[model samples]
Target chain A: MLTRFENRPHALDVIGVSVAFGEVCVIDNVSFHVDVGSTLAIVGRNGSGKTVLLKALIGAVRASGTIRWAPETRIGYVPQKLDIQRDLPLTGRDFLNAKADVARAPATDAQRVAGLVNLSQSIVDQPIGTLSGGQFQRLLLAFALVGTPSVLLFDEPTAGVDEPEEKSVYALIHQLQQNEGLSVLVISHDMTQVQASADHILFLSHHGSYFGKTADMLNSERLQELHGPTVAHLRE
Target chain B: MTYATGPGAFLIPLGMAAAAGLMGSIAVMRRMALASDALSHIALPGIAIALLVHVNPFLGGLIALVLGTVLVWAIEYRSRIPTDVVVGVIFSAALAMGSLLASGDELIEALFGAPNTSDSFNLIGLGAASLVIVFIVRYRSQLVIRLVSPDLARPAGINVPRLDLLYLLAFALTIALGLRYLGVLLMGSLIIIPAATAMRLGTNLRTMQTISVAIAMLATLSGMLLAPVLCLAAGPLVIVIAASIFFLSLAVRRA
Candidate 1:
């Protein structure tokens, strides 16, 4: 029996999604759906295709299947590379002066600094080149906040950030979800952030694996068989 | 701070070089550096064939540009050549065919390369001519950065393959025209090197890009003077200077 996940579309849905690079399939014949305003976290090993799956959903990277975003869906993404380019001439102002309107106005250096209150103001006027790692990440985060995207995708959001900074990021994400009901999808290996933020977890193994509530997914027998009850121990 | 000695002698190379730098930087950052170069080489066959057929080289380059972009996209997105290796083969073959096809009296000059006989007036005038296209696609520069962030660029509604096409067309036109000044062997290098050198030191994309243009401008002026003094080919000389800048930045990065 086929699941109706493919038959009809919600706000955003993926059916029979298959993405491949060379001979190997990263996302092999997978299908999933997300309800409006729900948060889903994808978990897997480094090469386990979680990122590919997320990318497929956003229709960025190619996949063979149907991925329908809700009408007028504006998707935001923060890539794995945080310190992307500090040397671009754009002041923080230039970054916000973009197509989307997720953040507050004034979109100037001062406003951007105020928005990213974590950084000093002097660096705000400085061209993007001089930023530290956290600062760069902050800049992209601010960009992500712009345009009030209907959905947000963070690919390894905390990969290089410090622990405290990760907490701040999670805090911001939580605020977005709570205040605006921002439909968010996070791809990460960090167990705690997933447990903390993810309402739903999609554990993608070599093939499409699990999709359910985070707690339920964690409590599943396969996870226990694979990781020897580390998920249970983390409950404490 | 090493400024050129001659009055406005820098303008000629500056015009062509800056255009090349901007285009090439996008190519390099997108990891489509080889693809752009290959497309440039591919233009050779089209232009040469067009010349044989008594048509416009620019028109020919356009055809090559279309085919080149499609070929790379097919090889890159659709096929399994691992992107990098595929482009490598594409460029080598394209350059070979370009060299072989662009034969005749103009052929020698094209392959071995030639110095631009176009005066400062002509070069600067052409630069002005190209500004409209630049202004129209200015939004593209911002969008291009997203392409560099393979993770971020695509989902932002930036069709990667389409941008690749746009880039290939722009590069083909630029490359076909630029070959007159920068020449075949070294034009591709000059197009992208200044920006790449700056990327080493600069922390932000904008600063790196600005400095890249500035550096390319400097290298061009210096090469003009240095080529005569050392009795060397202008293109290779200019490339050497640019290469030195890259190494200098890498050293500074390590230091």
Candidate 2:
């Protein structure tokens, strides 16, 4: 199903991307491309520079590389856990409205996206800090859904959510992807979900990096070489 | 150092307090409560310099605050240092330099404001207050988004760094506006206390801002009215009232 977009135009192309902090190199000379309306799952160990690469792609960090996006690319990014204070007075509605206002989307877009994410008015009206992990994840997804972005970048979308909720979140993402035909780049630890949902995989490690069709790369001997013996456990 | 009588006296401080409240709400949300207080101390050395050179102290303080805000912004961006750490370091140096330059009485007045309200000062204060209020109202959404996360803001087409600089500038300006009435030592209290109280009580963003501004204005008014009766300085009295309100808010459970 996902291979249909392979013949279409490229949504993003990254060439020779490298990121360094002081003397330590984080992402080293990585290159990959994603076709329009396709899902690319980025997998890595804890310190493998997965988040850094995403930040570099979104221009949030300085990197020496060529990151070219198709013309008129509107990106919606859902970051990992934020360090927001528990007593913060901002409600979920405030967060959504703020995104809508900044993106120049209509004022009603907040309501529209809330419906898409299955967030009730009461849930969106509560202070963001008071939200449960699952509710907050939904809120973040709803925030990303505003302005009808063409590209969605998610960094550990289910980091704080429970096990059951994780599957639902992925389902919601898949539904949105199908409906909107969005190009998605997701950083996830769930290998099973990545295998089931993603069309392509970009695995980063200190040892080496690999990017190719998900099935081809998953079945290749290079996966074992790059990921070490832990590859067997990862598929569980 | 004499207090002004009549409407200009009442109106200017009220406006300044309102601006302080609004700015403080953001400051507290940004986790700059203590840092913001420290930031006010940066104005002290400027006031001392103004006293020595016979220039308008407010002007000197304003210049210093703007420069200090820029310095904070530059250091924060360049080194990726936490803002509180940077402000704390700068503040200590500023306080030391300020105390060394000014004598006992001059230092006391600058630290704990002796309002010598002039027509020019009133006009400038009002205008600055207006600017702060307008900016907060207009760009509140962007500020809220940026506060949540800069990554979120960048994708939404908001210029995060520029907005940060602008916010720092506005914070500095609000501090400067209150310097004449609250002084460097006490001005930060006027800003932080009311907002702290509001944070305890507010259910949402709009309520938070509204409660903060109202509390700030009320404290200013009560301080102005009760100062002459209590035979005390209005600046300190204003902070006292604001602090009292904050303490009072502690009793009410957040909904």
Candidate 3:
């Protein structure tokens, strides 16, 4: 899918990057590169340091070794389901306006990104706590889109959304990638979406990791060894 | 002692109450209700020490509150402990120590506040209260983002640690502003009750803040006016009014 970007400049490069908390080594010697305007899917089982790896890439956590991004790279991050109180007084518009103000984006950017995510004005005006799971996901997407970031990092973007809305969320990400020319790094458990959208797959596990083209990784035996019998369905 | 009852006397408390409303809204949203309440108690020991040393108790309380804020921030940052836990342990100790140091009427006044005896420090308190309001309004966007998630705020170009420090400082200042009227025992109530009420009734950020400020000012005005008439202390009366509003807000169903 991303073959067109084979000759494009690298958006990110990771060399022997490792993160450890005290005695526990989470991610060790992980290395990969993402091309501009391509999507890289990070697939792994729970507690496999997938979220930690994303944090390292975004400088949210301490990691040893080299992880570099293209000069002037701006990243927008969408984290997993946040434990927001149902009675929280913040509206979606307030959340978006906060991002716009901090990012120093124009006043119009909030409306533009809200439109991009297909969030209605009425929905955006409602308190964030009252928003449905899918609406909250869209709000986060609009938040990420506000600064016109060149790259996006999503950690289980649709974790709490319904099955029907999950597909639309990925579709929105795909559409945004095409329209905005974004490079995406996402962590997800849904392999079907990965096969549909990802140019490359980075399979991380307690044993080791495999980083390569999506098709090749799906076909490789190492994926079976690292992912066990679970990934056997992907070969079909 | 001749207590100041001029119109000028009312201005500082009103401004301080408004600042408490604004600061408390963020504090409650951050889920720091217990921590903020405990944080005011840290001022008690400072007041006791100031009385012993023959210094202005307000200055002493302000210094102690600032120091306590920094300590809480540092411990929370270094150990990854929750802010409430850190504040709880530290401020509780301060309260115990304060009770031991001051005695009789002086201690009673420090814990529950006394009527204003002089207007000499009113100007400085008003200025400090204005600074806190300005800080909350100017940096509310950043504060809101940080409250939601530090990771999101960091990516959006906010310095999360620095913002946290500044916010804690503003919170301390607001508490200090109200200490004269509400005392260490009741100041935190003024901050939390109005914001908690606003959280229940407000549909959005703007509404929440507006309602919180209005409730705070109303409570302050009513308590200040009614305390002398009813032969009651203003600090307890103000908190009672704020708590009453909070209880009343429970009756109005949220939209």
lDDT of each candidate versus the true structure: 0.65, 0.90, 0.90
Clashing pairs in 3: none
Where does model 1 exceed 4 Å of error? A1-11, A14-32, A44-48, A64-66, A81-117, A123-133, A190-192, A206-208, A214-231, B1-15, B28-39, B46-66, B80-84, B98-105, B112-137, B196-255
TM-score of chain A of 2: 0.96
DockQ of each two-chain model? 0.28, 0.87, 0.82
**For every candidate, C-alpha RMSD to the true structure in Å:** 6.3, 1.6, 1.7
Q: Please, what are the lDDT tens digits per residue for candidate 3 over residues B162-229?
A: 99999999999998888888889899998999999999999899999999999999999888888878
RMSD of 2: 1.6
lDDT digits (tens) for residues A155-193 of candidate 1: 877677788887787787777677777778888777787
Give, for candidate 1 chain A, the lowest lDDT window spanning 10 residues.
Answer: A98-107
Backbone clashes, each candidate: 26, 0, 0
Model 3 CA lDDT for position B201: 93
TM-score of each: 0.74, 0.97, 0.97
The fraction of reference interface contacts (C-alpha pairs within 8 A across chains A and B) present in each candidate is 0.34, 0.90, 0.81
lDDT of 2 by residue, A95-214 (tens): 999989888999999999999999999999999999999999999999999999999999999998899999999999999999999999999998888988898889899876789888
Off by over 4 Å in 3: B1-4
TM-score of 3: 0.97
